[model samples]
Target: MNRKLLVLPAVMGLAAPVLAGCGDSNAGSGGGDSIVIGTTDHIAVSKELPSPVDPATSYDGGTYTFFNNTFQMLLGYERSATIPSPDAAKSCEFSDTKSETYRCTLRDGLTFSNGHALTSEDVKFSIDRVIKIKSDYGPVSLLSNIQSVEAPDDKTVVFHLKASDATFPYKLATPAAAIVDSEVYPADKPLDGLQMVGSGPYKLDSWDGDKAVLSANPNYKGLVGKLNNSKVEVRFFETAADMEKALADGGIDMVNRTFTSDQIAGIQQGKEPNIKLTEASSPSVRYMFFNVDDPTVKDKAVREAIARLVDRDALTRDVTHRTATPLFGAVPTGIVGHSNAYFNTYGQPSRDKAAGALSAAGISTPVKLTFSYPTDRPATPNKEEAVALQKQLNGSGLFDVTLKGMPWKKFLPGAVKGQWAMYDLSWLPDFPDPDTYIAPFFAEGFLNLNYPGGDIKNSLLPSTRQTADRGQTDKDFLQMQDILARDLPVIPLYQDKQYVTTRDNITGAEWLLNSSSTAQFWELGRGVAG
Candidate 1:
């Protein structure tokens, strides 16, 4: 659900609305202090979103954060853990050795927000709607293995797959496979607007276009675990400055994203007495992709040449101020199947090497191409990242590059249609696995490079997905990473480090993000109650 860019009003610079009708002003330690989180990460990368709340079409991280708390699934990722734990289901497993029939049993006495039964039928309806709609902005690809679904009983749901896939549970653990209320959500269409009705940990109390208020759902009977703060609010800020100011002014209890380098440095140096910072090696990765269908980049040598000239270390150090680290492959470090394939093959940036590769392929010097990036992600440094990228490639004197920035609405669709010759995009895994890093970009190309992934998709990907033991498939992933490096369809720029800064008194800040870097607002607490 990433490439979680930015939403319309949020991207268009909507001001963060203050909390309404709240009695507590204490943002620090104390019982009943309502936890408020501030961030500039309210980005959604959807095309047909009349409202960016539908689980089917809303495939961005910001929306996924919202979905995780409101809509329950059969399985969910444990905090900082990859293995799926039971959520709505009391038990879930493949019924046959073929790994084709996935079955789950709902917990007893489950019900929706309106007291309607939360049955296997609702689960079947929700998943079927996603498949039938097949929105370009949705996670339809993740569930492509499903041949059909059945509600054998009110409490039991069965999924029949087109092929044997042991990783089915991992895919289902994500919010993409969210279970919605059949009575509320339309069968053939997405539920329009931000109206949420599901059985999860939190209920959407109110959304004033900027801040969304969430309260503990009394009807929720899932695996969301214990709630630290019973009530929480997610406040979207227009800029990093606004977010930091809100945190400093006690308007919010924590800051999730877009903090300036100076602010981060100051906090790390212990300059802020009231602040506490928690960080982790992040799974989020950003890279440059080439549309192989584009005539300018059709040649493999041309693609490989650009990869050689990219200065990743400088991009991370100067632009992001080393908040991020240079990445050599699609899968980041700490993940199971990570490899330094690009670094192994191309080494560091070299103008001579790039030029030599191009000349050897009989491609003329001073190749002309357009480098595209998104302008809609105002909260992020898209422009700076793009300008720096252009300098790396064009300043080589072997290429003449023109820089272009389009809003995400126009940019994403064009990218999916294979319109851009070269563009920069960011990614966070739909699930914490190597296939997430490789397959989405390769199989028909999520960046829609219009390149049939050839061996990677046809051979390697299917082979890797055949087993549940993710560690055993490292060899296949290693080869896939090698092929990506050899072909040079995309170049990995950097992987970010997750940072969540909260008031010193706030507890459980480290558990704010799960294994996939999805936000878990339920983890934060202020003080123990009587």
Candidate 2:
């Protein structure tokens, strides 16, 4: 799914020191009270909402905001922790040394929001439905290793895997593993539209075109603990500027997602006295994808030459204002098993090395290549970044570059159709793991709709996925990274940090930075005196 960005005009100024102030007196604070959280994420209407908001079929950041809050998984990552812990399950563990068999005991007295009993049968049904439905966009791939699911009784559920997978628990924490109400939801097909009967901390009160109202589930007793606010109103905005204005006018209490760099710089400069900023290094990364079918990039040496010429430091410092980290590998920093394979392979930006690569391939200077990027992604100024990228490659005098831009909707499909020789795109992980980074781009044909070829698809990817040991998994990934450094199917440009702005009196803002990188509404409260 394309993470949409808001495009904003360049506003130049030095950032002033931030000054923390008290919460706005006129605004309703989220201190066990109701508050509106504004975001630029497009909220689909009841009819337009993806099928059932069902975990089996729904996949996207915009939809997960609803799924994560409404549904509970058997295992979920603790706040700021990478390891998965029990949520719906009282306890869970692999029963065999091979990690092929897993057993979980459900928490007693569990009930869905609709008051239906939640048990092992429902858990079995949930996992089975995901595999049976096998929607192309669905998360069936996450459970590919799962051979069968069994429920011996009301409390005990067991999973038999075809192979050992150490990351299985982490996968259980994803929205794809959200336990559904077997009685309310069908087993054969996806349920239709915003209709949900979940067992999470909150239940859907109402959902309209502009906003979604969530009320804390009184029957809920899960691992999320107590929610500070009783009700949460999520308001959607079409533009970053509109959302910022609403935040300024006290129309909303907090703003997240798709903030322009200029807006972030403004917030950092204390431009809005009522707004406070919180920062965390995100697992999101941006990279350039090449269509191997294209004659220009088919040669591995040509790809290597281009990779050597890229200047990530300049891209982050000049365009992103140091808001992003210069990424040297597919896996972004802050995640386990991340390695700077690109940096190790191509130490620094050097024109001589790039030229040498081209020379060895019997290619001449002034290589002609066209670069494509989206015009609407405002978070990092994709267009501006593409321009900077073009300048960097052309400056080496080894290539002639042409730049093109389109809206993300068209650009994504066009890139998939092999319409662009080279295109730039960014990825926010479906789950926080190096596998999420590697598997999507390199392993399968997920992005290979147009170009049906990837270098490591057969070699390192399958080996990496099959490995059960964390230590061996890391080694396989590092080896994969080295292969990627040489093959250059995609060039990792940079990784970005997440920024959320709230009123100074808002407490628990830091807790929003969780494993999934989704906002944790339960962790936020306001009206606390500063």
lDDT of each: 0.78, 0.74
Q: Which parts of model 2 have CA positions greater than 4 angstroms off? A: 1-31, 45-52, 363-370, 375-380, 394-421, 449-473, 527-530
Q: Model 1: C-alpha RMSD to truth?
A: 7.9
Residues 1-530, model 1: lDDT tens digits: 23211110111111111111111111122236678988676643234557578888877777788888888888876565566767888878888877788888878888876778899999999999999988887888888889999999998999999887767887887777898899999988887777888888888998877888988887877666467778888898877777877887788899766576557877899877798877666778888888887899999889989889988899988777887899998777777668899999999889999999999999998999998888856446788888887888888899989988887778878887888999878788887677788877897355687767889988888887676667777789889889988887888988876677898878777777777677777778876431
Best by lDDT: 1
Error of 1 at 468 (Å): 1.9
Candidate 1 error regions (>4 Å):
1-31, 43-48, 260-262, 528-530
Q: Candidate 2: how large is its RMSD?
A: 8.2
Task: Put down candidate 2 lDDT per residue, 433-463, tens digits, no spaces.
Answer: 6778887666544565243335456656666
In model 1, what are the clashing residue pairs, if there are any? Answer: 5-43, 6-43, 6-44
Question: Looking at model 1, how many pairs of residues clash?
Answer: 3
